[model samples]
Target: MHTNLSSLNAAIAGKTEAEALAVLADLFPGEVVFSTSLGYEDQVITDLIYLNNINVKVFTLDTGRLFNETYLTLQKTNNRYDTKIQVYYPQTAAVEQLVSEKGPLSFYDSLENRKECCFIRKVEPLNRALKGAKIWVTGIRAEQSGNRQDMPQLEWDEAHQLFKFHPILHWSFDKVKEYVKVNNVPYNPLHDRGFVSIGCGPCTRAIREGEDFRAGRWWWEDESKKECGLHAK
Candidate 1:
């Protein structure tokens, strides 16, 4: 069913995010999957999928270092939708080896060490979760980061050999917040505390006034680009 990217893009062209999501669900049925982080942006996408009654399977990666508030939001979202968003975890053996060799807080030491830890914890689990998925849904927005500003709403993910759809790629942060509030969607309260991008607890912090959107995550690394391997090309 996924033999042509042009057809898929045309099918979703000019449609609203929810409408496009429904189109993908109809096109691929069980092959469409969504990854959620329970943040404001993701919570809005969650509402869109659940309310629209889309048949997309939604899941999240647990890096074993996420904030407690994020866990609470996950539970609230599950209860609200009566749908069990799947949970994927890092492999135990790999985690043990990495921790034993580099210690638990090795991600703070250097950019290489951080990316290695991210690969073992977040990226590896994501790969497993998306094993047979044909389309991967996300909450990525252009205004969130500089690199994402030019991204299209729907595009092919060459690395994973699947379609990556950011339903709200062009939506503003205020729009996301408004949708979450209007729909009564469950979201991580950390966003209210200036923590724009929530990931691992120790690796994240609240940003200050006039700071960049991703300023909170990995603030220590000045020379390296501030990103985990999750969304890297």
Candidate 2:
């Protein structure tokens, strides 16, 4: 229940983004981890980690249904950074059971089905990746969505039993793109095509102008708040 982030915030105050991450890396040693989705924001974080040689573990969850552009981005990121980002996959048995029982496209059937697929493909794999990690780094920017607008730069993740540090939480989306461009970081090309939040190919689409950022994801559902359980509170 200890959630005071002031001390941690002050620790990184006046430091550069990579420097702040380096501070956390030093503070937690091998317990610091960052999860990337190969998006613009995450690409920027990956640049900072690899470009700066920060001592934090970087990994991604392969949901077995991601866009080809996503995998291409991962490859380009690895080549650009000269480091291989660790990948975690859903347990084989669980994926087999789900696919054999409900078929591959069952997530479109109902919210429950979608959530089940998300849990099996993303949430569970993420849980396994974050096991024993002390600090969970993320590329969460406040401007991305209304729900994330009030997120603190650093906070305790009760569910993960660790601290979640959003190094660029207050950064604007434009700033994120600028960072990626300036650093020459490799990113998913789908972002240029209007895919704001890239996930599984079948569940995601490119959003048009004036649409909400979350609209492109799970467009069929009537629910305004569409999530795949990765950031569920």
Candidate 3:
């Protein structure tokens, strides 16, 4: 880990998103890029990047199984921001190989199968999208999952060979919603319908009140194995 995590903590201790973004811009210069899923927090970060005219590249993983609402949100964000949000897709051969060997819903069979699906649909494409990028920005928040609690705002990603940055690491869900509403940023409509942590269409569902933010994702699996391979540090 090559980041000055302590300095990042101090700089963002009481600062606003705008302040944090400004510092990030100064620190990363031309190497910053924001990866979005178009969720509420991602939308907030997208809005911040747009509003400030940050020169960061914006991209998304268009897993073939994404919800219709997610695609709609992507369209809306492009129209509203007038910026091209690059979409990355998995290699055709890789996807075809997986589907050919094990049917489309193989992820429901076992943990190994699920990880295989994630690797083909998300992780591989994400790795390609981040090629040559120095700073990988995300909307990850600590409260989203138990495993995410110890994440820092800035850290070294040995897997990606770059610095991973979580701009909203300490933000609460309420704070994220407030920022979205206040800024009128475009977001996934599924969020309004109860999908807290939206992912692939077949793997995600709506969560009830008081459930964990990520309860909607991979609800069929054990809580410890809920994550897709994209965000692994």
Candidate 4:
């Protein structure tokens, strides 16, 4: 489907999260999909879609390296909403080959190795999850990373061949947390202990008091190389 980014943004302008999601679901029906990582922002989106009963398919990529808390949050969300959020996983053969050839922890050796692992675990599965979708919704916030600062609320993703929308793109961290709290959404408990970004457990950690929002992810790498290719340009 051909989408005009400017017109799409204008259509959802100033609408509440649920309202905007309802509009998208009505417009695309089964063609709109939302990907969540069980983070705070994602919990808010889950609430918007599930609680409001929007006609959007929700799914998560299970990389097998996720935190225990993430799994628990996923379970809690499913029970609370009475919805089964679909799961997409990396192909078994690709994962076997990568681990067999490079060994676990090879991602620490170089940026190339890291991106390769991410491609096997995240990017590839993301492509599968996004198949046949006309729109891909995400929980990205501009303030979370410099890479996303220039992203608009609506944009065409050439790699995925769909329009990607960030419902809370301009929202603040505090605003997201407050929404989660007020809505009684289930979120990863790691956020309470300084883990600003929750990805695969091995590559993620809690940040210090004055650290950047994304510092907790791939902490050893240069700040510019931290993205895992799932959201890269």
Worst 10 residues of 3 by lDDT: 1-10
Model 1 per-residue lDDT tens digits across residues 113-222: 99999899999999999999999999999998777778988888889999899999999989988888887888899988999989999989999999888888889988
The estimated TM-scores of all candidates read 0.97, 0.95, 0.91, 0.96
Model 3 per-residue lDDT tens digits across residues 153-199 = 87878888887878888999999999899878888989889998888
| Rank by TM-score (best first) | 1, 4, 2, 3
**Backbone Cα, N, C clashes tallied per candidate:** 0, 0, 0, 0
Which stretches in model 4 have alpha-carbon errors above 4 Å?
none
lDDT string for model 4 (51-130, tens) is 78899999999998999999999999999999899999899999999999999899999999999999999999998889
> How high is the lDDT of residue 70 in model 1?
95
Weakest ten-residue segment in model 1 by summed lDDT? 223-232
How far is each candidate from the true structure, as Cα RMSD in Å?
A: 1.2, 2.0, 2.3, 1.4
Question: Model 4 residue 186 lDDT?
Answer: 85
**lDDT value for model 2:** 0.89
